[model samples]
Target: MRAVVLETAGPAPHLRDAVLPDPQPAPDEALLRVTACGFSHHDALIMEGTLRRGVTLPRVPGHEVTGVVCGVGDGVPASLIGTEAVVVPGDIGHRRDGGFAEMLTAPVASLVPLPQGMAATGGALLASPIGVALRALEACGVAGGETLVVTGASGGVGAHAAQAAHAMGASVIGITGSPEKAQRLEGKPWLDAVLLDDEPWEEVVAALTGDMGADVALDTTGTSLGRLAAAMRHGGRIALVGQTSPDAAPFAPAEAIFRELTLVGSLGVERRHVERALSLVAGGQVTPLVHEELPLSVESVTRAYRAVKRREVLGRVVLRPVGF
Candidate 1:
């Protein structure tokens, strides 16, 4: 098997490919032939040492995994063999070997069967941008006829959140720091409006909502909470995700108290969320936002990481063990 590992993680990290023997599955696990895996901004953060907890050096860092089961260990079902599925990340990518290799093993219980016709690239993101976005939406109690704001709208979770919110009959305002991203979101049917992050986005959100303010917000950029709260209607809910932004978002405790806003921190996807993501993809409610797919290699992974760090990627950059 060929695998990519983070040989060193620091300000200037080192990553390279290696030739290794295929891993054998545990008694309760299944061995999969890797298909597609997403290169998440989370992966980039680990690579840059911005996030170090639970990560070990010389590790395989891809968690957004999808593959075909080729063999099952003792006590596992043979029916699982040849089943296409997505690995629900627990210890796989963060604490153990992951999908960067052409083959990897995962607990059979952690695999979610992929729906027919969902491409491997899209399946790879079921547990990530799609599922994570849905989880955030659920946290915020998104509903039809409501106004919703999606921060970092061009990125994976934000983009999918905007789409799912729109599909649920909400009016979505997608805000992005890049004008290029604003332009990109404008052409999509998911968003009612697109606002540049440089603009007074709060004012725009207020104006767009006719001063009633957004009924709910999906805060992908964990920075700038005070402004986010200001744009929300009193009693509105805000679902805050990971630290996607470099700068800190100034928070106002008084404002949140006075507004009686509900703030919930959302992270990681459940098995149910992954299933819902599959349903959404099957129904065309949400398009898997794959920026591009690169073949598994050291140079390809490096290029994808650079693109993610620059915020140049719209959605996710996926990698395939085999060329498409």
Candidate 2:
């Protein structure tokens, strides 16, 4: 089968054609023909050798995968054949070869049936970034009518979280670095306000809530964007989901203690959150903002990774492994 193989980990991965033995599904597994896969910054981190511990070499890195079940192993239900599904990217890309290929073999338990209206591109993203957003909100205990702030709101996870919070009746405030991105959310019903990341965050906060500040803040910037941390109201909850800036300084302990804040760390979307995200997409309660779709050829995969590393694209980048 044709797959993007990572023979060595470095600043970049080698995208090439290599012949491999056909995978034999285990008794509880299903063989899937991959249709689409979502590319994330974490994939780049894995390639660059700077991620969580215990990452092994020569591994397939994609986790956000969507495809159709073609074959099932013993002990797997026969009913899943011909069904569209997405494989959950489990445990931070561990113990599994990912979806960036012509075919994938994953446990049947990890498969989620794709809803009728969910597109392949959207399906692939739902299991990862969207799941993270939903889990973040749940962790922070956000509720309707409460104000929530989303830093890096233009990114994949941020956009989905903003919409989910909005759907839950929270007043959503999105923070972005570009006016063009701020303009993209103009007609979005979920957003109560949008602010530029470069502006004075305090002033923006005062204007949004008459100086009360946000009830919850989800930071995806990975950096200690002081404004986001400062805009939280007393007793506000914060969920840290990403580290765009790995070397960022810690948030002020004194400030957090004085405000009686709840700061929680979130990573990897669990099975339950992935199910909720899929259901939301299936019901059309939320739509993923897919920015680009590239062919699954070797060259295309390399180009897509470069674009992601350079931060040249907005929203999600999907790879079409099978022509539609």
Q: Return the top candidate by TM-score.
A: 1
Candidate 1 has what TM-score?
0.97
Candidate 1 residue lDDT tens string, 193-240:
998877898998888888988899988888768888999899999999
TM-scores across all candidates? 0.97, 0.93
User: Which 10 successive residues of model 2 have the least lDDT summed?
Assistant: 88-97
- Model 2 pairs in collision: 222-243, 222-244
Q: Give the poorly placed runs of model 1, Cα more than 4 Å off.
A: none
Candidate 2, residues 1-324, lDDT tens digits: the string is 777776677765555555566667889999988888988877777767667466665666688898899889999988899888888776425446777778889889888888776789988888878998999889899999999999888888888999899888999888887787788767778778888877886578767887877889998886644566678789999988887755975567776777788899887787899899977877778888788988876676677778767666567889887552
